[model samples]
Target: MTLRIATAGKGGVGKTTFTAMMTRALVEKGARPALVVDADPNANLNYYLGVKYDATVSDLRESLKRDQPPSGMSKPDFTALKISEILSENDGYDLLAMGRPEGPGCYCFVNEVLRAAMTRLASKYAVLLVDNEAGLEHLSRRTTDDVDNLFIVSDSSIVALRAAARIKLLSASLELKVKNISLVLNRIKSDAEREAAISSARDIVGKDTQIAAVIPEIAEIGGMLSSGSNVFLLKDFPREILEPLVSPHET
Candidate 1:
């Protein structure tokens, strides 16, 4: 069984950065052939992972309306083949971008086909890491339904904590089959700010949700990102901060 992990938060909350770092850490720890899905419409995880993708799932969905499979090929098989073609294979993982959001139309057939294809593809990997948008659109669509760990990231701010809290509430309403949910406070500058964020998060996300990690504001990481360097190149990245989130059995 594949270990499914997902990161969710509002825009500019560093969820994407966290996802990238976690991917590098997983790869370093011998978690090979992981499938990293960039579910964000903005789709910049490729840059963070130092990989490039030609097409996105959205492009394929759009093409399905106009393109047909070969005379003897089934639509599902063709869709799966296209998905494979778009995958950006890297040293230890494959990247799949969700691309832009769906346009004005009913995508029932296209969505079902993509979902089935994703499931088939994910089974070949040991882990599946998804970088989700603020709205949790992919989860709502049931594209990646059974998540093992859902990390809600938030910066050290009241507003960000509130947004994280709302995400926790939304996840409950969606009834996602998530085994564990944790709050990852990112870019915390001081202990006071961390305490405040934790307090706010507890009130907003409830006491049941644990505060899994609080990553400090590391200037090296910022510099590396600004230089368009991949997360793997960062020196002394606080990967131990993510250890609590990954189960021992899964690793």
Candidate 2:
């Protein structure tokens, strides 16, 4: 069975960073080559994973919009072919970026197609780590279904905390069948502050959604990212971050 995990929060809160780290941790646990889906239109997960790709699902979708496929092929067949071709490979994971940078008109049709393709592709892996856009728009749109665990990442700020609350509330309102929704407080200065961060996160998002993890501020990580370094290979990322995510029972 494939485990579906998603990360969300307002921009700049390190959702993408955590997504990449957690994926590496899973691979370390023997779940090699997990499927990493970059569902955000901003599309920087590829950079964090240290892979380069020229095509996105949106790029393929736009081409379909401009020109019809050969008469023998159906739309679904074409979409599937493009999805298979665009997966950027790495040693322990593969990436599928959802769409290119924003363009004119609605991408509803393409999103629907990509969603279906992602669902189909996910079963081939032991885990699926999805890095979503800031809000719950993708969840609301049902781009991902039966989300096993949803991790809402936030910085130590009121705005980011409130955004996490709204995501929990919106997921409830949308009736998403998510088994667990946990808060992740990132970029703390010290381990001693974890309790305070957890308390604050609980105050904002409520007690039901526990603060699953607290990631300390590692300057090494900042330097790595600034230099366009591949974070998946970084040695300084605290292994404790995986404690809460991989073994939620302990948290």
Candidate 3:
């Protein structure tokens, strides 16, 4: 079975960073070259993974919508070819980006083609990690139909926590086939802050979900990211927060 792990959090809460680190950790644990989906429009997962991508799903969407198919090729066929070409292979994972649509026209067709293509592409991998947008509009749209583990990451700030809560609530309301939902507090500086976030989470994120892990802020990793250095080269990563996630399910 393909284990699908999707992340949700407000922008700047280290969601993308966490996703990249988690991918690196998983690869270290022998889940190398897993399919990584950069669903966020901002599209910086490539930088963290230290690879360059030729195109994005959004680029395909615009191209498909704007230009006509060549000769006898159908839209789906042409899209499949383009998507196959855009898959960037790197050391520990492959990157697929979802770019923003260019035109003001409706994107229903674009979404259909992209979602189907993603679903088809996912079948080849053992694990799929998606770095989603802050609001998680993709969940509501069902781009990823079934999620084995949905991680809601947040910073220590109450505003970030509240955004995490909203994501939890919004995802529950949608008809999403989510198997498990958990919270992750990123960039924790002290025990007191961790305790406070855990305390607030019980009320804000509801009873069913739990604060699965608290990641301490690491200056070394921060410096690497700030300098646009490849995280995979860093010998130390937050395994405390990522190891549990690499396995199939947490007990």
After superposition on all C-alphas, the RMSD of every candidate to the true structure, in Å, is 2.4, 2.6, 2.5
Off by over 4 Å in 1: 70-72, 104-114, 248-251
Q: What local lDDT score does residue 40 receive in model 2, on the 0 to 100 scale?
A: 85
Give the Cα error of residue 60 in candidate 1, in Å.
Answer: 2.3
In terms of lDDT, model 2 sits at: 0.79
Per-candidate TM-scores read 0.89, 0.89, 0.89
Candidate 2: residue 244 lDDT (0-100): 51
Model 2, range 1-251, lDDT digits (tens) per residue?
77788888998999998888887787776766688888888888877877887777777766767766678998777767667788888777788888754455465855776577557777788778889888877777776557788889998888999999998898888888888888889999876677777777878889876777788887777777578787666879677668457643442
- How far residue 26's Cα lies from its native spot in candidate 3, in Å, is 1.5
Candidate 3, 204-231: lDDT as tens digits:
7776667778898877776785786877
